[model samples]
Structure formats: C-alpha cells, structure tokens
Target: MAECAFDFEVLALDGTPLPLSQWRGKVLLVVNVASKCGFTPQYAGLEALWRAYGPRGLVVLGFPCDQFGHQEPGDADEIRTFCTLHYDVTFPLAAKVEVNGKGAHPLWIWLKRQKGGVLGIDAIKWNFTKFLIGRDGQVLQRHAPTDRPESLARDIEAALA
Candidate 1:
C-alpha cells in the first residue's frame, strides 16, 4: 500500500513554478532542510546519494524551510549560494517554504496526509524530515529527522530495482 495520488507544483529557488508531473518515472527523495540547523550536514549525504543514484532515476529534491527556529533566514540567492559552495549540492532545490503550521505549503499538506510520524502526529517537528517516493510517484516511506541519509540508501536501491 502506497500513497500515490498526490500531485504538487515545484518551485525554483527563485520561486519560478514548475510541474511535479515532469519528474514522473523517477524515484524521488523529498527533504525539508534548514541551513542553520544541526542536521544541516545531512546535505552532504543527500548530495552523495544524488550523485550516486541520480543516473539510475533517483533525485533528491531539497525544500528549504524556515519554519523551524528561523534557521533558514536567508533569501533565495543566499540559500542557493550556500548549498553550492558549502555542500556542493547538485540536486534541485525549491524556494524557501513553510513546511509546518497553518501556513505550510500545499505539497507538505499532502505529504503529512500520506504518512504521519511518531504518535500519529501530522506536524513536521524539525528539519531533515524526509519522504521517499518511488518511480510510480507513490510515497514509499516517511523518515523522521533522526533518520540518516546514508541509512536510506538501501531503500533507494530497492526502489531503483
């Protein structure tokens, strides 16, 4: 059983809107990130995964969010430069968005509906929240902030297979 019915709009770092449907037929790892958060280092692991499996249809789409402690206070340009210089991130990054609370982005609303976290809570507690989507555009898993990107490699491999 998987959550496959949701569709969302993709926005560039500059807020240029795009269609998620264009990424169909590929495996996706969607993550909510914050530049100043302790888990920011996860960006390195995510980039590694993207470089390793990208040719095999895996893409790690990063969505920077400032909803957590204002950790991501930079504008789009700053955020883009930081990701490139500090993490060498090559995967697509969406514009800064609110991933939790009443003003949360619509894409996140659908994500929470598909899989609630510990104790059935629908809120995203912090940065580094990850959702894995299979080639069929189905939600395969919802990983908590504590789940390491390296640990998700097996699942990504399975999805590719």
Candidate 2:
C-alpha cells in the first residue's frame, strides 16, 4: 500500500484519473457515499461543509459504493444525475468503488488500516463512513455513518488551522 493518502489515485465521476497528490497540503473530508441509503441525505450537509470550508483548503470527496445493500448501484452518469437532482452536490466524487473484501479500493484499504472500525475491525461496516485527512495526507480521524456532516465543522476548522 502507499505510504500516505496522497499516494493513491481514484477515478473521477467523469472516469478520469484523479490523483490524491493533487490535493496535497489540503485538508480532506473523505467519505464512502451511496445514492439510496438512509444516510443519503447527508449529502446536503456534506455540500454545506464543502461550501463553508472549501475556501480554506478543505475538499470534500465522495466515493460512491454499492457494497452495502446495493444502495449505489448506479453508473457514473446516473450517480451524477442523482446527486445533482437530489442533493445538488458540488464536491468531487470518485466513481463507484468497492470498500470491502479483496475488491476494495487501494485508498480505502489504506484508510481502514490507518483508522479501523468499531471493535477494531478494518472492514467497512456501511456507507457514509467518513475519514478526516490532515493537510499532510495523514489519516486523522474516522467517523461513523451516523455522524452528520454538519457536526464536523470544528474538526475541519481544527484541521484547517
């Protein structure tokens, strides 16, 4: 695995290669998202956070995943349309990715290793799992799916500081 979060690359919603290094020195709020899950509404809150902190070197990245209940089984275009119509998301979004098992994305695997789940499990438990990344690309904190995006302002502020 790569040494830091910046050492990974994930496909953008447009299917272009997007490298994490491009956001180096910026605080990142990385989330595994879904289109149809109960926590899908968090997208709005995430967008709010992005708008609130983006000017201060904060980038909110959403990665669509279908591992949980097939919630995000849409292609890039479908996902894009859904997000636009439903949440009006403007933050960056990675293409669909697997967040568990052998098919898990490299960045995800590294993230889990940096901060495990409840009971010390590395495997993701559900969608909307959040990771706060420092400006140096180190994993700073892991938040559960139930953690609202609005609740992270202080954490983001601290990271930005």
lDDT of each: 0.88, 0.95
Candidate 2's displacement at residue 64, Å, is 0.3
Give the CA lDDT, 0 to 100, for residue 137 in model 2: 94
Q: Runs in model 2 with CA error above 4 Å? A: none
- Candidate achieving the largest lDDT: 2
- Each candidate: RMSD: 2.2, 0.7
In model 1, what are the clashing residue pairs, if there are any?
A: none
Candidates in order, TM-scores: namely: 0.94, 0.98
Specify the poorest-scoring 10-residue window by lDDT in model 1: 1-10
Model 2 misses residue 17 by how many Å?
A: 0.4
